[model samples]
Target: MASAALGEELKCSICLYFYADPVTMRCCGHNFCRVCIDHVLNTQDLESRVYSCPGCSIKFQERPALQKNVTLGNMVEKFLSTHRDGAVISCTYCVDSPVPAVRSCLLCEASLCDKHLRVHSKSPEHVLNDPSTSLEKRKCSVHKEFLKYYCTKDAICICMSCRLDGKHRGHRVEILAKASENKKKKLRNVLEKLVTKREKTEVRVRSVEERRRKSQEKASGEAERVTALFIDIRRRLDDLEKRILREISRQEEKLSLSSSDVIQRLEIKKEELSRKMRHIEELCNMADPLTVLQDPDTGDLCDPEVERGDEDIEENGVGDQDLGQISRISHSLADIIRGVALYVQDPADTLLDVNTAGNNLLISDDLKTATWTETCQNHRQTAKRFLNYHQVMSRRGYISGRHYWDVEMSKLGVCRVGMCYPSIDREGDKSVIGDNTKSWCLFGGQGYDNQCSVKHNNNQIRLPHQISSNRVRICLDYEAGQLSFYELCDPIRHLHTFTATFTEPLHAALWVCGGSIKILGRSSYEEP
Candidate 1:
């Protein structure tokens, strides 16, 4: 039961039966029995070689090649042939019972009665066939009327009367059989070219696919490297935070110890000074002033107390002076400690100046302000011509913008790509902007003359730490997914046109990143 259902599902929609010689339409992606589509089209007003599917209403610009589904068609044909004895089909003209056979005539648009069908068979001009062939024949306008003879002059099937007409006079024509044979030979030639074209297209598609795969792989690898770098930087930042906190704690502890020492010294000096001052006041207020007063002649009881009081007065004065000094020193130390605390607490105090001359330059001088006289002296004649050129910046990086300049070449063709050799000072290095270190190095050479030469040409003309610009060309090869630096032969080589295959496809926005060499025009690839 399952197998039977599967077979029914494969049947053509238009025929409402099992498929008979199926042909798939390229545009609509539908399959139908060949005879079914032919019959459907036969009923319509035919004009275009292309067709639209009846089921989906999809149009086909390129007519798909008709392929015969022999398995399905043979099965249907054999089934019908086997049941031929049991099936009943009456003659339309006679309205008679089951006629053993049914046939159609091409010349006459009518189904035949058995007696009348014999007349069609006997006529050499009339063509009789099954329904499918008969319908195809009716579609041929020229063969509508019974034409046993061929017009040799016009290469057409015609009645003997058309040949006798004066209209075909002096024309060289051949019978349709010979013309048909010539047409088949022409068709064979076209078929051979179509096969070749299809093979070429398939190869081109495969090549593009391979290049795309490689490009994706390279991008993935680059992303992974960048991710790892960010991870390392994050770890370092965490370590920096921990170190900063430890240093702050150490400074705080030192300030705490110094404050305690200063406070203890101030308290001790204050207490000692207070005790001596009391002793001096008590001695000065004594009842017997003469008795308290000290005498110089022979030590006696009358002057001993006076002498001790004078000694105490002197000690109190010295203590007061020492206390005053300690108070001043303590104040100075407190102020110093407070200033250090303020610096440690403020974030701005920790930041180094970012806008200094030695830092990365975020601003450039307004070159337009340079006087015309200065400009002419500073810029080379060739460089001045490209003064209008600008730079292109994208999320990825900066690229050299468009410019028009000429390089000595021998060809006259559409411009493809350009390479530039710009004068650069060896001191000017900007590669750190994109973490690309290789671009900063110049094509190094000896003394004044070598430096002068390199400054005039592109840096790609030499490797890092090299000493010559013997040959160099920076090429943008899209297919290779690479902006390659190459060495050119000396004496200024000619012959500009060239093509090469690449293992990968290129990324977009690459030309935007200014290279040591500038690309002048557009680039494209030929089909593989």
Candidate 2:
């Protein structure tokens, strides 16, 4: 009775069966199968934007999130395993009081208790097996006999009469027990192969999960770095803006003081001029010409040169010097931004490919350094091997996104650092880095010349100044179609940039003549 009650509680209200994947409704806390509830919710009126629980009829404002009922699911699994055959069989003769049976007879089609088993028929036709409620399933419907053998051709169970006189008379047949055992052996073989495949698939799943974790970590770190950089830029810009405004205010105050002094001088000069005019009127009122001539020259009293000088001061009150100071401060804002280093989070891990190395070029065992030697090494000639030029390509290539790597020159003598397509010519002069359209490079010359130039498709642009630093950085933005080189110094300086639509994935290429170059791993921008 307890098991029956537990089974009823574990059953889903919609499906009326044991819960396969039990879930509890957030609104009413009633358990139901996940699929049954999802189907009911999906069929509801979407315009209403509401769902109703099947068990409790509780209306929800929105579709509620389902909470898995793990404990209830486990209870259903255990109940099914313990009572797989349903209710126990009882003796047919025990009408007064039903008692559990020990064995069931196929011919009599009745279950027998221990008290009746001793008197039951022991004939071969009356097959007795473990107590079972399904007695008709163990008999042949047509012959009305117990199934004794399995017909191989028909792949069905048959009785003794059907095997000898029925339609399966000429077919091969085996004892039912032996035939069932053989089939189990074949199924076990298939199960073993399936287990092996599943194990391999699990290993791949773990690898993919690890990759996903690393990508998430990388994205988080990059986001933090970028946020900090932009915050600094905004702070600096705010400071510059305040400084410029303060400079303008200072110039305005100085100009106001100068203009005020000029206005005071003009007011005094006007009073004097008015008094002179009154004096001239009195002199003119004198009858004698001598009286007018005796008066001091009024023209001399109001000096024209002095008045012109005061006018010039008022007209030129605002000078270009004030604006020049503000302009200089405004230009410094660009300098501050340019001082910032390029922040690159994704750095390519590059290694020299031995198969693509030229005969004269000797690659380090670690595959990070490439040196030019006079003696040609006995390397097997392959299609990818560079036969004419002393060059070697990296093992990996990139087709998208930004990547940065650093190269340090032990001896800067005719060394080239650049990138090239994997399909670059291998046996001709074009195979050399920067000689064809498929390649781009920064070429450093040897000796006192120490000249530097960038070459692409046989066209070279010579840089004005020689590069003194031996360390250089290469940056590639594939989507933007930009590849730039920078000289790593006290303050990193940009050497040149090449802009072109990349047609194929690019590999790091190196060419050495009299010196050696080593890869110093990937480059990362450090906050200054």
Candidate 3:
């Protein structure tokens, strides 16, 4: 009986025989013979492109890969080896020859072939089951009778004699079939729940896998970009170093030439003084006195009244002007280094959020530009839409790290560039950029000549000078809680900086009244 049950477990539903090269299905975890499953899958309706598991009837949109069940195959092989000859039970009645048994009678304690089964008693007590070698298991050891009843209290099978007179006497008992049916009903309920849990788990697993794949892709892209950026930085630095060295050498050469000219003039003056001294010595010797007197004393006798001043010689040597030029170059180098460091931060590629744009604003197809239209546009009504002001916020928000982006505006327009929390008012005057406490902005007035101002919480500070350029750069350091604005001119000038502790993620906010503003830089929607 044990071997028969084990055989049933190892058998394939398609072949109705022991598994050969057993394979397990991923969808239903059912095992089948590899050749049998492949043949069945191949015969499925190709037009429909749907296949099902023969064991569980679970359908699949596409054919699933078959995983070889090595453990099951090994179990089958072991079973076959152990039961090589005993696989088919022989009839006890056919003692003269080995005849395969069709059924075994528990009441007779013997297996019967077709010929013997016909002569066997046909009674309820003579229970016949599939041919099994272990018939002793069907009888109760204590009562020596077939187990026909199940003790509910003890949860065991027993014979009629045990139920009536043995230790199980008077215990609540049921027919073996009824007990098995009740247990199966409970197990089916459990199986349904397990199937539901498995489905939900599969969904979660797929979601996690997708996130992992995206993370790897994003990391790879970032690494490549960073590598290229550093390479370019190194090249620029190397070029700058070489240029500075050349400038230093050129300055040194110019100074050296100036000093050389001064040295040559001094050498000529020294030779003339030596000749005057020689003439003076000859006069002292008396024979040349009359000749010296006759030679006519020129200005050379009085040391030639030093023509150039001490200042002239000093000027020919290294001076403050030369050092000052080199100092300025060094400062410029420092500025370039600082600018490159800032540039290394990820660009805030902000796209205007269409859902947040006011009805009077027209958003560009690329979502980078916003124009103030004279006529109202029919925009979808949403809670985030600005009903009172012609304003819009960026689709992306930042909670940490540094970001910078440029905004190019028409010189004739009045526009406000700023940062605002997502919870800023959407339908009132407070919704206007820089009008509420939740936002801060640099407001450019109607003309290029008009000075700009920084505003927040309805308070404004007018800048001393007009914004000289149409391009503005906005920088944010979320961790430091600093938001700064700069006029992108020949030399970028700082317009204003607001310092405050940020309590929520901030979006780049914009308000345009007369012309348009176009955002510039790569717009990344990734969250930090």
State residue 111's C-alpha deviation in candidate 2, in Å.
1.7
Give model 1's TM-score versus the native structure: 0.38
lDDT score, candidate 3, position 277: 82
By lDDT, the better pick of 2 and 3 is 2
TM-score for each candidate, following the candidate numbering: 0.38, 0.60, 0.64
Clashing pairs in 2: none
| Steric clash pairs (candidate 1) | 152-173, 153-173, 399-512, 399-514, 418-520
lDDT of 1 by residue, 345-454 (tens): 11111111112111111112321011111122222333212222111111111132211111111122111122221221112333111112222112212222332112
Question: Which candidate gets the maximum TM-score versus the true structure?
Answer: 3
Misplaced by over 4 Å in model 2 are 1-85, 228-351, 358-379, 382-390, 395-415, 420-440, 443-471, 475-483, 487-493, 498-507, 512-528
In model 1, the worst 10-residue window by lDDT is 344-353
**Quick one: RMSD of model 3?**
8.4
Please give the lDDT score at residue 183 for candidate 1.
72
* Residue-wise C-alpha lDDT for candidate 3, range 192-277, written one tens digit per residue: 89868966885676578668667777878877886886676577667768877888998888877877887776677679768878
Q: What C-alpha RMSD separates each model from the true structure?
A: 20.9, 11.3, 8.4
Which rank order by TM-score, best down to worst? 3, 2, 1
